[model samples]
Target: MLRRGMILVFSVLLLLSGSMTVFAAGKTGEGATPSGIPLAGLEAFVDNYVKEYIGQKTVGASVVMVKDGQVVLSKGYGFADVEQQIPVSPDTVMEWGSISKLAVWTSVIQLAEQGKLDLNQDIRSYLPPDFLTRLKYSEPVTMLNLMNHNAGFEEYMFDMAYQSPEEVQSLEAGLRLAQPAQIFRPGEVVAYSNYGNSLAAYIVELISGQPYHDYVQEHIFEPLGMQDSIAYSVVEDRPELLEHKAKGYFFEEEGSFTQGSWNYMSMYPNGGNNGTAEDLAKFAMAFMPAAGEQSPLFEKPETLENMLARSYSTAEGMPGIAHGFWEYPGTLRTLGHGGNTIAFATNLQIVPEDRFAVIIMTNQAGESNIVHGLTKEIVGMRELTETVDLPDTSEVQGEFMAARRPGYGFMKLFPYLTLMKLKPQGENQLQVSLAGMTGSYQQVEPYLYQKVGGDSALDVWPMLYAKMGDGKVEAISVYTSDYLPLPAGRTMPVLIINAVLAVLAVAYFIISPFVLLVQAVLKKRRASRHSVSGAGSRRLVTCLSLTGTGIVANNLILALRMLSNNERAYSEVYPQLVINYVLTGLAVLFVAALLISWTSKRSALTVRDKRAAILPIVMIAVLAGLLVFWQFYS
Candidate 1:
């Protein structure tokens, strides 16, 4: 009860602080206008962009643009169902993915307005008493924390969403299974979390005394007149709606397209709405007041105002998270969210000051840049106004790990696994190599850099470096309007050497059995002069062969299982763990045998042979150590 009272006070502080921040950020006139590019010629530019994308064989896409509470453009490009040759249109239904989080967030605001929910109260107050048993931090997880994406839940991977409705579990069941232990104290650093959003929606369900689906239908969709939209918990539950849904596709290696499987959401509110571009644009309109008319969807204008305000941000002013929206921090001051599921990508962006909004939906996954490009064209986002001066970055050269504070035992090896190289370009600029792509950044402040090249709106994109007490660079967090901090790990050198050696060892192991067989055939056919070897050496050779083969086989099985049935494969973690231990034991045995052969008097090996055996022994030992570090044998 005391905790509840404290939270209520905290909630009031957030409101007061939010209003101050908005005032400080200033009103419409204070911010920069849309890029100087004329809005008149933007339609043709977008049409040409979509045509080029279609020429590249993009499966399908729907785009809607609105300005001043009026629909400016609404159209689709390419085939919705390639095999059936169905053309997509503005009304084509597509899974909105994480963009659906907006509905969940808006519903929360509705309840808050009605005094049915408290943003500051402990989430446990709304959940079943025994629902969440693991708590790693002393601080309570509040609704505001969830909204800010600072709830401290570890990244959830297993059984997140499914391909079929039959495979999905109830929301309570999925939460119970996927619920992660708290890693940081609530309201710590930001880490985007789907589980956090789902939990918030579940809280909405409890307070409103209605199922989550029904509540959103009656309150949001119906009120917005979005007849084509449905926030479904299970994908296959609505077959009639499914008929209008655009089939999602993926590009293949042969330059062909393969239809992706349907995604049945387990965490419904995280990314589960399916709708048309026109319908979503309607919902986006409700967020802005039209001609002195307040939103029918929101109870009060103040609530809408607060929802659109900057709720949480880092010190350097990178818009971190705003209520349910992911701020596209730029000169335009846009509020939006990008969503990606199994095969579809969706983006909804709104520039409230201009009363302009856009929703882009695609049948292909990972096309966020396409939507961003469209927005940039429409707004004519400007280039950097002023280039901030920088300090010397001579000492800041090295590899940086994409920092993730793993809360679960299985994720202990996370820090040592991610890698990024910061190569010094000049005195004030550096190039970042991440996942085979290079991004050039110019130092703006003492420790921050803004990415160069691309739309001018992204000039505000910040890459901040945190230093240790002794003044050495400690960790680097890049702001893409979303915070991702990657700290330097000490294991890079060791991991690099180990990775090279392991690759060589696995390659030799795979080819050795076949090579031996071919050699035996050659010896028999050619009538070899020298016999093979002594009994003890031959036995040792056989043992090493079997162990290497087993290692290769185990990896193949796990990979195949993951591709066939991901959820089932996840449940096989214990089995994989057991296999790892068994393999480690086998590695130790092979090493012992090699030692015994090289040292014992009974061994009949030559000096060169003994030295040759050391390579495999070293290889196995390195692998064994890696397994131990990874807790693979635990």
Candidate 2:
């Protein structure tokens, strides 16, 4: 099934790369050639492209493009409420999602500019003593680490977002509740951290003596005259803006969508901004200005320059992250961010070199062709000349996992299951397969590679490949999740065996009840006496079987929780987590019972009886050990 899925995706990628059209631009527009890559007829191209996806993939979307400090295109597609026949207009407001992180970073820079906060200084210096309670390391985490998203925090999921406005807590309260354990030393890994971003906002609040939301409003939003936009989640107080806000939707089927609840987050600084696409365009434009003009957001051009500078990368010489923005490979360098909420998705990209920008927002959740595919087409990829001396690729071929994954809890082992594999396709080419998607990359230089041809905009290439290590490929960095080498025992064979065992273990218990009933009936019919060994082994087998069955049931529930990702899951996780711990205790009892049964019953059991009982016990024991190793209990 997995192989077929990968093959299907790979085939689609080939088809897309071969037939995809270049998104064009209006020739008469001021910024038409801002990228210096002529997009002849972009307006018509965008219209046709977006028209096809409007009702199918997204109920509504707002798209705006700016060039040479002028609005080249500002258009809305589909219905804000499909049932109401209400068209999405320029005034339609939408959730900005993670693109909201930009305002937080901008605030950080403003503080740095005022000398109220230092980027390199330890963040703990700004916080109240004993504020952080989840550190696994004593290393001082700095503001630079927060901006670079390498603060070593795990991906703590629960309580960060809720569907109810009342569930939203204060920024400080949210940070403390969702605070994740640090599993890596500061600066050692580039795990993207939302808590880190919000923590920076808390520091802003602590220094400015204002709530984080107020600080953004007074300093950033008001300055840009984005009165229609609000930094707060839910925007419960802004009735006017709320009324205009496009209803968020989840695609049900073709030409069908269901309205989803608004995404409310207590740590609103990271991803809870709701605003119009025009307002987001203004924010994107601020990051990139006309050559000699300084942005109104900053006191000086140098501050903006420093903020846009590279802070972290998986490999050196690759364009990775620029403060809060992600760098994309193009003829002209591009920096931007993508965002999502419960029912909306957005993209913001800026070609700083050309003072050109594109902002896309959709009412759809999870996936959007315009937000991802059309935007990628707008900010196109370019080939770079490769002539530098670099290391060989043969030694770097292996499995890797995303750095942005849960470092602790029952979810810790999830990343291992979808390990990314890089196989050598040629001396200078490698095929990457991960999470059911495969793409081919051709090495341009010693350590840099570009995606060959991808059907989807979500393909892993045109990446500024950062091979970050002394002489070996330690980790390869992408825009978002950098890939780290898989640890020992997480190879494909081991994972396949583990999956097979999980399935067989579930199967054993599933069929055992009927098998036992049939055996009892047959014995009664024959009036046969139970074997002495079988009777002695029954208790131990029952204990082991109960433990194994309980573990399977617990995992099944957790898997369902993952699939039904909604507001209630946050409250449900703790109860499920406690069950995981109880199952571990039962597993311990199984081991003890097996030890006693094997030693005490050895003399009485016949070879067939011993073989039948012992193998399953041993198999259950191995399965339990594997689960423990994967940290499934916590």
Candidate 3:
């Protein structure tokens, strides 16, 4: 009776709290899997680490660790569906996010092995003529450019994903809709491009005379027996798999969580794999070929070896890309990819030399701890060979902006706002801050810095390659993207100045109406002599004030709408752009009127009469200048 009463009390509290959590039962993968590795402690370690974050940071999570061609650990925790009180099991499928790119890369290699695809030849040779409409340079983009993520395409911000599964478009149509301009020349400026990866997938479709998914189903998934996985936006083709899929969630606080919409992508190859933890373990095991055995994913053992070889590096003795896999900091050479969807997160890492691997998946929106933190602990710290005579990091101390950001339009401001600040932490070390994730790095080589410690974001990006120019750092490369020096207009001081000016302008506009009302009432009460300030001046102030307020209102409305939605297709972005253009035109007209008034010099406007008009004019003009400098109008 006591135990039952206690359980009832716990249930009532759970209802009151709203963030339902159950100590979800777990299940092990069924197989005659062997475990010769000294990784027995890993299962307990993962459980302890995961228990801390299950209710606080993530609703449910699945973890699988493998070593020496055997399953070290595979388990699930917490609730897959909190409202339904359904406990997550080993078979509970979750989105694989960018880890889906592994399949695309694998397919690329399979064709290359077959002598059907050229890694060095121009990708344009394979695509239909004029398929690329936004080239800025005449240089050829090769398959390597896509793999290394230096194809120079700008980050396409919208229509790559939709909220509704019904909105899924064909792969070709999705590519056409979100194709970004070639912002940089080919073979330079490494930026993580989703469009580039999907384009590669499309190339697979064109070359094989089959859809990319079908090709994957035959070449990669079927060989590894990853039957529980689907790489498209929705699993309509596999209803049973979809039924087992865990619903994604967004955690607000301790005991508060909201369901998140599934991210339906037409550019699905970039980040759309959904599967069970056990099945992903099977996929991960493909990379670790046992002695006298060949990887089933590749036709030849040499082909798999070549695919894992270093494909790109920003500096010598630094972690880089092995074909499509980003190198991870580990005791040995660890290579794999991490992924994120709207609400699901996953990571797959393998130490090929050690034949060890780890996979973590969670149904948490923009997850951190499990996918990054737990993985880091699993793939222990790499022993540095350059411990003695470490290089100094003085030249790299400054604010920088990531290269993996929209290089066009108003959305460009986002990269600036999340600027990375690197400052001296101690001798031979520097503290790094970007996007609310902070960490410290010690210079192991002249241009290479390894992450000593940080939050999950830094864990996700553990090593950096800094380029020195003259006396300062030119760029800092981290996995798929690089961080370049912040332009003068994008510096923190300049942004603060812009913000202070905008606040003053909005504050002025907000209060100006009350002032005008008082003046009207007084004028009605008593007809005084002709006012000192000219009607032209009053009209200018009132018009500029109204325009400024309107711009602010429009921005707030758009932001609120976007933030409130679980999915973002950016269908409304075009209309918002039109509104911005109209407001910009009004601003231009105001500038013209003010310029014409000043040039005419028909009246000697003084402080008592003209100062009020000048304040708004100065404020708005400076704000406009800053916006133009930051490419907000583009």
| Cα RMSDs, all models | 11.8, 7.2, 4.5
Instruction: Give candidate 2 regions above 4 Å deviation.
Output: 1-29, 33-40, 250-260, 290-292, 314-317, 386-395, 455-461, 464-471, 489-497, 520-526, 531-544, 566-571, 583-612
| Ranking of all predicted structures according to TM-score, beginning with the best and ending with the worst | 3, 2, 1
List model 2 lDDT by residue over 1-634, tens digit each: 9999997676433322221222324434333543343434656767777766776666777888877666666777777766665667778889998999999999999999999999999899999887877888998999989988998888886787888888888999888777788878898888888889999999999999999889999999988878889999978779999898888888899877898888899998999999998888778778778878889899988999988888777655466888877887766788888888888988888988888898988888865578877776787777656665545667677778888888776677778867877777876777777777777777777677777754454442456264646756678766676778766666678788878877787788666656766765776688535545466566556666666677777777787877567344356677766786787677677667656766783456555655766655766667676667677666
Please give the CA lDDT of all the candidate structures: 0.68, 0.76, 0.78
Q: Candidate 3 regions off by >4 Å?
A: 1-37, 488-497, 517-527, 531-540, 559-567, 587-611, 631-634
Candidate 1 has a TM-score of 0.82
In candidate 2, how many clashes are counted?
A: 7
Instruction: Tell me, by lDDT, which candidate is best.
Output: 3
Q: On residues 457-539, what C-alpha lDDT tens digit does candidate 1 reach at each position?
A: 23223344434335566545554212233323435676777578667767766776787688567767875333454445545
Model 1, position 113: C-alpha lDDT score: 88
Question: Candidate 1, which segments miss by more than 4 Å at Cα?
Answer: 1-33, 36-40, 253-255, 380-383, 393-397, 404-418, 443-448, 454-475, 480-490, 515-537, 556-569, 572-575, 585-618
Worst 10 residues of 3 by lDDT: 27-36
lDDT of 3 at 54: 77
